[model samples]
Target: MARTSVRQLHVTVLVLMLGALSGCTSITKHIGASPSPSVTEQIGVDMHYHQVLDTLGPPTRISALPDGFAFEYESFRIDERQLGLSPNVKFLRWFKLAYGTARVARETYTLVFDSNGLVKAFGNAREDQDAGKGLAFQFIVTVTQVVDTRYLDEWPGQHAWGVSMLQPLPVALNREQSLDSGEHGIEQRGTPTSSGQRTLEWR
Candidate 1:
């Protein structure tokens, strides 16, 4: 009986230690709503400004133009994940590893109105970035893991769970144009482009 009791105690202690050493969490934050793609379909040149507002809700910003005024809609999103390894003991806090990654996405829509309160031109732009990666020893903090830096190239493979092997393209070109202005513009780029209105997506 004594031998059986000793084994049970060892198993329980091991389980507790394992739980304390493996602590991880994920967080996602979104600010503002993505512009509706269908809104472009519903809107047209000479459309009343109030009609555009009624279809798209409210604008993020408004600017006065020499011809009239402009309405701008914007959206932003953030994705973060963290992994922590350390003993539960307070004294062992310094013996910990923190790893994490953060991603950012943004988009914008612009409408130029004539003095008659009618839509004269419209355009859209979007951007997405890996932001970066983070790694630290002996601390309770969030990590931003960016693999492009190659700083952690030599890091141990055991931490594979916290590492992202894929690297985003060095640069992407985003072009925004007014449906009527017939102008060429270049902005930042991230993922593939789709037809109609643009929206943000996480991989």
Candidate 2:
């Protein structure tokens, strides 16, 4: 099981490497080549959509436009693995000796374009932020039980659950310069979730 997991991991990473390599080539070929659409390079609202697509690509998401237009782009990373031994085997080594391996991925992006072709904004929306007026989450989840546990006669004796979380952060690639340039006005926090949850889960 361990060997097989390692092999699978190797294959998965190989596939990702190929994908990245291919992306580099394709991305470069299109660079500096997209046509300047009518009203394409404007930085204001009400821009061109086709030029945006030529510059970026099909939006990952799109808002229903009863009156106006908006679009978003999204991407994700997926990891998977298989672990060893069976729960019913009545052997601790089953789980102790085996567990699958996978990946912790971080390649996702989102771009929201208002009706006027130019990018309204771009970000990864898989975050807890009131500021995320445009971003959206793109993630995949797979749930599975250990083989031994599934076959074991003692069912649900030791209840347990798994949890996962992610947060988005961006680092400046250019010189550090604030719009204020001279002063920093920051808001201070008083507590951590400090307020706390008002309602009980059971209630």
Candidate 3:
């Protein structure tokens, strides 16, 4: 119940942001501004990747590919359900919804630049990589989903939440590498999950 309500709220907020973004299309941005800016003009036609980073800083999501890499800028709201909250809220809406205590996090937006420092070729050539897939480059992280679709890259792995917060939640590899699934709460898309582990491989 709590997770449901939280998702509904997230949808509501996203709808509102979309409505606002509609008016800001082609909106150019500079550095140091709050909420950053739209990702299109930052990396589209005639635009270079370095300029995007210069104006937007590091991308929110980054992934590697066969020949080049991809840059992804994204924003998300990690819900209580994502952190293992379904058990307590299964049949108690009033207890959790009316009086639930789940922390919320926010991000403005991200900028994605391709390996050769160019814009991606997608229908929304103007829209940021966060809204598109088939990235010839690196990562893609959104409000409810994350995908790593690349070739020739040495992918990474993760532990079962690790034994300590001392270690990263989904630990990363040295400077370059790093790293998924479950019915406990998360449902794997495009692929089935094994009993209790998420396998790693190059795409």
Candidate 4:
């Protein structure tokens, strides 16, 4: 019985060592991206819905709107690397803590379609950011901001084929645009008011 117990202990240690080795290696996870830039440029108002499906495959989410439908396609990639003491160097474990670095890249494409099955408007947004947690902060620092922009067929007070689509307040594209329009302050927090306008909040 003693010999069997010793063998089991050895097996457990070996398994743990292998796991540590694997963690030390960089790992990457990704989702779909096929048609590439061409598909992005091709998406425009009045484009056929079938063409969208053929170029980008099925959307990740779809919602039914009163006049038509909304389709959203999203793809993201995560890259991670483990640092600090690993089981391969068990002696260092007593002095060093495990930490890691990670990067996330995301892309979202949205298309709004009318009841006729033709695209009414489209938007594409992309983001890349770095993140780190735990004791790693002592050695690594990262700062990032997440921003999303949407382009619609119409702007404020604009109507499309008798349908009025609510538009968010215009966001200046550059210093020049801001100067020309003057500063338009937007509330970043608090529940939406009865006016039906939504605020932008960063996480």
Candidate 5:
């Protein structure tokens, strides 16, 4: 009876250890400055370029236009979730599996200035309808999910316990990627022209 109790305790300890080996982690990262509603309200068309700069701080990117230059202010909020599985046993200790997904929310404000340094056009773009579809962001998530699924079923031996054995992995169905997906949160339309004045388009 004492031997049976010892065996049961060992099993319980092993189960708890295995459970601890697998864990889920969440992380959040904020990039660039997010414009407050009050500050953004102060921006308007025909405002001096310097006014916008002074009001909203520096922009994330700048591009030269035919008539003038353009300033792009962007902010990103990224939330990432990952699940990691590792074997405590010595034989499979080297094996590790990790699956992760990142959701990126972006806000973009653009200011187009004329040669006179006056704002010709201004607009704001927010990632609402189209979020988590970015090339770089989605690519990483897809690779992790696919690899996680495939590796799980391809475990060695006649048992066959890798990704193939699992009918479906726990991946988010909403995560989608496309070749034509706009990498930029704010897209620019048409090419620069040598006309009287050029303006930027926001979609």
Candidate 6:
């Protein structure tokens, strides 16, 4: 009897460890899928163009504007589960041998830059929906729920340079434009026009 009891104890411990590993796996996948530095950390009106590139790698799209340039970045993740019910409902259904429909969640992020290569704005959005398999056509519902969406703006100040911070600005022979240039190279297609005006475009 003692031998049998020891075997049972080992089985119980193994089950517990497997359960913990499953949870950790889920958390790890979520963290690994997220974008590093995130939009919030990199969005700043006075931030330089090179700094943005170094932090976020490269944008998904780049556009030349009459004023300066625009950079767009996008990222998304999708999670799918075999149950469309709450945790409590799913647990109860498990005992009854009743199968549940599938549910899916999707999250998205978008960032945009202005003419001077400074961040113009950024947004994060999430959506949740349900999916149905064959023979479960009745359960197939076209229900799309927007979980959340947030937007932030970071336009350059009219005189951001005038407000000095005691330390002298960095100097380079090619840096002809004022701080309004956002420290971007003049080689970019959209250099400031002769009138010193900049333009912006969004889609």
lDDT of 4 by residue, 25-72 (tens): 355667645236666897889988898888778865565666787776
> CA lDDT of 183 in candidate 5?
22
Of 1 and 2, the candidate ahead on lDDT is 1
Which of candidates 2 and 5 reaches a greater lDDT? 5
After superposing candidate 5 on the true structure, give the runs of residues whose Cα lies further than 4 Å from its correct spot. Answer: 1-17, 128-203
TM-scores, each model vs. reference = 0.53, 0.30, 0.31, 0.49, 0.54, 0.33
Q: Which residue window of length 10 is worst by lDDT in model 2?
A: 23-32
Model 3 regions lying over 4 Å from their true place: 1-42, 78-115, 122-197, 200-203
Off by over 4 Å in 6: 1-39, 63-69, 83-104, 126-203
Instruction: Please list the C-alpha lDDT of all candidates, in the order they appear.
Output: 0.58, 0.31, 0.33, 0.51, 0.54, 0.40
User: Candidate 6, which ten residues in sequence have the lowest lDDT sum?
Assistant: 23-32
lDDT of 4 at 10: 97
Model 5 worst lDDT window (10 residues): 171-180
Tens-place lDDT per residue, model 2, 28-145, is: 0011112123322342343466765666665433443323445533333323344332222333212322333333232234344544545565443332211111111111122332
Ranking by TM-score: 5, 1, 4, 6, 3, 2
Best-performing candidate as measured by lDDT: 1
lDDT of 3 by residue, 96-122 (tens): 111112222333343333566665542
Per-residue error at 126 for model 5, in Å?
Answer: 2.2
Q: What's model 4's overall lDDT?
A: 0.51
Better of 1 and 4 by TM-score: 1
Clashes of each: 7, 13, 7, 0, 6, 2
Off by over 4 Å in 2: 1-47, 65-67, 86-106, 115-117, 124-203
Clashing pairs in 5: 152-162, 152-163, 153-162, 153-163, 153-164, 154-162
